[model samples]
Target: MSSHLLSRPLLLRHLPSLSFPLSNHRFRPRRLSSSAAVRPPATPEPAVSVAISADERYGKKQIISVTPQIYEYILSNVREPPILRELREETSSLRGSQMQVSPDQAQLLAMLVQILGARRCIEVGVYTGYSSLAVALVLPDSGILVACERDARCLEIAKKYYERAGVSHKVDVKHCLAVDALNSLIQKGEAGSYDYAFIDAEKRMYHEYFELLLKLVRIGGVIVVDNVLWHGNVSDPLVSDPRTISIRNFNKKLFEDKRINISMVPIGDGMTICRKVLQY
Candidate 1:
């Protein structure tokens, strides 16, 4: 990997932080085309008085809500490879299509891989292989990705896409629980060997996955956790569902963790990108 590609500044730029001030760098503002520019309504509508909800009054507005039109524009702007587009289209008809990562998220994952110049990676969930294919496509010919998934059917779909993308050799599919696969990797003395990892499996086991991944990934390696926001339910006091609670607790744990630096981004539900700062 080129030294410039793996520069600390480049890696830290993507991983937001408040603990340390980021080095000042000039960034060119994106210029939108005339059609893509946001315009106010042609006709001004009369303002109507509406009672503000408690949540609305006190809640912080950081990330913008992605409306359907906005999402369509994002999809049009993002560059999706032909094979990934085909896989995403095919996965949409499946039963758990919603579980798959969005195209923009996939693009982000691929960019992370390239930015880090990662050679070895891991994917805790492989739903229809959309994200995995994205990562595999960006990895070099010698790069390898250990993909763990229990669903045989989903794995089969992933395998088909991997073959079509001609990156089958780069993916090592493990048809077992994520915990077992992660443990197996540790037992084989692969601790702190991976360059990157992505977790999108069982919500309840997120903490466990983090602990294991911390050991498997070397110091400075990156771990990306998906669905951290749980459709905005994590902050809702009324929603005490098991899955929501699990994700909420996981987010808290990540916040308190000092071994890794984290940035929770509101993209594709939500994703927390962690960079290991200390070894386990």
Candidate 2:
């Protein structure tokens, strides 16, 4: 096992927002230790929308602490293209402009896709294509990345970025509820055909996505869900925020799930990675 949190050096401040689309969302807590505890998501969506803890993806997870050198090394590996940089600026320039994915998380997304050798993949959300670009860059040349996003403005940015990245040919950006898109795919008997999937859309509907993802990904395939840490509120029994409660419950369910092997890593906010192991 790695060293304890106390054994680490002085952690640096968040990457100085080097890119236009970088953010430590409002749910972020501005304190740090060798280990950092994340804040949960507070965005209000339709009650019927997916019930994921959006804050958790953007919120920093309670880290047990890795060395500063380790942290820097991870950040240095993420590539930031000039076209993506310009798109980030354009999206953030809008009113109520709310599109951002940290550099580390985006790079991590790429790593996951490559490691999985993902071909048929899905992304529940695509904000400016940073996440889409990350995954698309690493997918096999013949791979297809289906991005389901509801916001046209965000999709516009995502499209622009993918085109700029020159991988637009490999991506399919659909404007619709992620669940709806999956349902349509299921109708075509596309379940269990995808090799990897990422969920970062409406938080409340996370459970729904997980259920469908299990069907879409074959055994040994993986489904990576973002934002399960929910900032620091998940552990607080008294914090009755519905979103926080939902995430807490999901984490519990994932652990008991004999269908997959799970790991809740302190990578970003908290990424719950489940490698499916069962049939059904």
- Screening candidate 1 with a backbone cut-off below 3 angstroms (N, C-alpha, C), the clashing residue pairs are none
lDDT, model 1: 0.81
Q: What is each predicted model's overall lDDT from 0 to 1? A: 0.81, 0.71
| Local accuracy of candidate 2 as per-residue lDDT tens digits, 200-245 | 8777788999998899889888888877766556767999888998
Let me know the TM-score candidate 1 reaches against the reference structure.
0.79
Cα deviation at 71, candidate 2, in Å, is 4.9
Consecutive 10-residue window with the lowest summed lDDT within model 1: 12-21
Alpha-carbon TM-score of each model against the true structure: 0.79, 0.74
Q: Per-prediction count of colliding residue pairs? A: 0, 17
RMSD to the hidden true structure, all candidates = 11.6, 11.7
Best by lDDT: 1
Over 95-192, each residue of candidate 1 has an lDDT whose tens digit, in order, gives 87878887778989999999999999999999789899999999999999999999999999999999988999999999999999999999999999
